[model samples]
Target: MLTYQSSQDISITPTKGQDKPWLLLLLCCFWLIPGLVGHDPWKPDENVSMAIISYFMRHSDWTVASIAGVPQFSQAPLYFWVATLFVNALSWFGVAAHDAARLSTGFWMAVGLWGVGLAGRELFGRRNGRLSVVILLGCLGLPLWGHHISPAVVLLAGFAWYVYALALALKQPLRAGVLLACVFIVLLTGASWADALFAVLFAIFLFVFPQWRKFSYLITLITAILIAIPIAALWGYSLKANSSELFQTWWRYYAWGPFGGARSFAVGTSVGFLPTLLIWFAWPALPLAAWSVYLFRKELWQPHWQLLISALFFKSLFIMLATQQSEALVLPLLVPLVLLASGGVDELRRGAAAALNWFSLVTLGLAALVIWLIWIGLVTGMPLTLVDYFARFSPADVHWKGWGFVFALLVTLVWGRVLFRKQPLGRRALTNWTSGLTLVIGLLVGLFQTWIDVGKSYRPVAESLSAFMDGKHAQCIDVSTIAKDPTAALVYFTDLALDARPDNECLFVIRQTASKESATPEVLWSGHRLGDQKEIFSLYRR
Candidate 1:
């Protein structure tokens, strides 16, 4: 590792050997486990995951990606298989299907945190590694997207492990090869081949960098690729053998079209606005990552800077050229940025660090209090000021004082204890920030999980639609205008027959619209989640 100028005074705290990795593990658990379960499949992503997993559990189809008996766009499904494995394993212990499926997030997020911490330790020192993990855990965007069902999270794990394997490639060839094998397996199997291509690109770019331009690194990459080949090939062979047509469809997914079919572009409005998205989503880490570069302006060519900066630059280019954006696409960039920012923590001016730490403590401390107060209003309906605001989410009939309350209360107390403790010097500010972020998420999910679910989930609508169907002879229903979120939820939660055959003798149609429209025949059902304004569903009999 290249030592920083004026290193003695600014370094984190000497070269501590291990830095209590177990503590980091415990923090990861705290950070990862909270919002994993205890709620129904919510909105676009989780509902889609539940639909796919539910189908897989019943049919055990290894080669095809079908949801509700309809084919999916991207066919490579190593990620879904991992989640299925988790669901199957957890079912023996009687866990709910959706909850079990969500456990996959915790498992992969842990893998990511492990890789991130190890890379920090490898490239810098133990303290910096732990600090890196802390800073990442504290980032505003991670907790929001990390705990959900998305291939982006799995790709995140791959990136974290990729960097670690890259760090160890030349020196610890054997271990690095094993880690890189896992990374490739992750990139190859579970997610989109489009996103995985960048991992491979990053690896190739490493060869072009001075640090990775060594015979041993080349050997390590080849070994890992060789290890990953048989597994990927097996998946391909199975899919091809199962049905040649299915394999063809899977192969042409993004190659033929950006989002599963031929399309000019993908989701999000524009690629140009991505940096703006990164501004909030990447949070404190993004700025610190830039600060790391500024601090070492003279050492841009150093091996560490070159590796980190090149990774960032390549991912930036990939994000722009890919023509799609989300919190997920922004995720891989964090690994390099956090690793880069890990060193910046130490070099931060003492006064600035102190001011930032106190500011975090005060802001987070107040935020926690407000969360508790809002939670209290949710339970007792006291503090009438908040009651009106909370009503927008949940009905007045919704009231709870369950075990989640006790759990959240304990968490808030723990956060409070940490906040009021003696002021921290260097790394403690990050600790406080991450803890506060976790606390805020915990309080919201624990206290008002019911409230949020009431608004976000399509369970109520699905159940109502199912009841409406049961009242009459079961018949195929038209789903011409229904959005994907409700569509997936209905498929997962109900037994209604959904189809889009306009010529069929279907009497019922389910359509979503911005404003309710009058149907000539008697309407079956018309409603939406109370807080959702983007869509309202109406079931009509034509």
Candidate 2:
């Protein structure tokens, strides 16, 4: 029979061959912080969020979140609040507006990792805690969404803090007040009322287990509510005072709105599809976490399991039931999932461990290799097929960066060494998996960032539209109506207030009309078609 020992039996100290936690952490930073810094805020969330921050910077108003002059109620001001600080602070160093704003995500991403490590340590031990952070670094969804300047990413940080602070409520009961303060911060920083509600529910669920029904735990939760409500009320009062219309709009649209679409609900209801989703969505961590939960079936009563499951339950419930089912919704679940996955790392069998190692070595190794090949093809057209393929999509003016190649090559070399190194099954395998994942992410960022920028950025379209407006000397433009992408791009490129709603005073109007119809409004004296007949945009002088 397979036997298991307590985490106390394992050596927390790293041997010479093993990947040190600090180095693993540094590698994660390399994977996370690099591309996020230099890139423009790519559409849909990044640009939208950054635009709001830019608006706040120009106007210096925290009471209402907006883009251009349009008040946006979909998100809370907390994300923009933090991002605005970076936007102004980094401006001194000559960072671009979007790049400076995105600094918030980088800072919070690090906090999320630190919180994951702490939760793991509190639940398991120091060794598992470090390993848990590694596992989180290797998660499939993080690289895509973790760096987003959206409220969802900020919610992720708040969720991580909630997990860490909750663990503290039981372990260090004397610091209940401190833990409660963290809970208050979560409510204040979260994107929506739903997120704050989930946190409260998560706290209550922790005390549901008989063993955790202590006076300190109860008092901490009660205090958390008392602390959180007043803080939330203060923001609410300010919002109401500054813009009552926005306050009502937020309450009516989002506060208690029925959430989730057919696709998202399908994930919750359909047993058949969930496994498929989990396979790619949660990936290596989900499988290992499932295995760990199965092995520790009798120990589900523990506070760690209780808290993780509670958080997972509420977050998943919201994702499945909400009106919009974005992949970004999965961000909040990563911390608890990583902590649970770390529990199974030590109990993993030799064959299973070997399988994981080989999987990482092949899959991530191949991914890195492909990214390198593409990067080379982009720089030099020796491989005519890849060159032709890329030329069809990206501009012919794309240039090679010598520094990108050097950085990518160095990271790939380190990845190769980790892959080939002979080491024991558990922690070594986990660390290598994270290192491989980081290397692949690094390759994409270092090599393909500009390429990605070409496709995703709205700057070109924005610039094209701006060219039509240059001679007119219009102070502000009016968008009769436009989609999200074009609207955001116009705001950034034009550097003018765009009114989408009906207004009589605008000197110029940009509208998206039917292909057969002229984009020009009838009331305008004259208009200029922004693009060719195939494209839809017209700048009209009223």
Please tell me which predicted candidate would have the highest TM-score against the true structure.
1
User: What is candidate 2's lDDT per residue for 1-542, written digit by digit as tens?
Assistant: 01124553445355666645566666777777767766666767777776677678878568886665677766667777888889889889998878876677888788877777777877776566677788888888788776677767776777777787887887575475566566566555556666676677767776667867889788888777776787777777987898787777766665542342222222234333334566787877898888888988997777677777777777666666555556666677777788788888877888999888878778877887787777767677767887777765555334565676677788888776766645457767787878888888777777777767766666766776656456664567777566665676667656655776565467777667555353334534222222223335556666
Scored against the true structure, residue 1 in model 2 reaches a CA lDDT of 7
Tens digit per residue, CA lDDT, model 1, 258-298: 34433333533366766887787777788788888898888
Candidate 2: residue 346 Cα off by (Å): 1.1
The estimated TM-scores of all candidates read 0.91, 0.88
Estimate candidate 2's alpha-carbon lDDT, on a 0 to 1 scale: 0.70
**Candidate 1: lDDT over CA atoms?**
0.74
> Could you tell me how far off, in angstroms, the CA of residue 302 lies in candidate 1 after the best superposition?
2.5
Lowest lDDT block of 10, candidate 2 = 258-267
TM value for model 1: 0.91
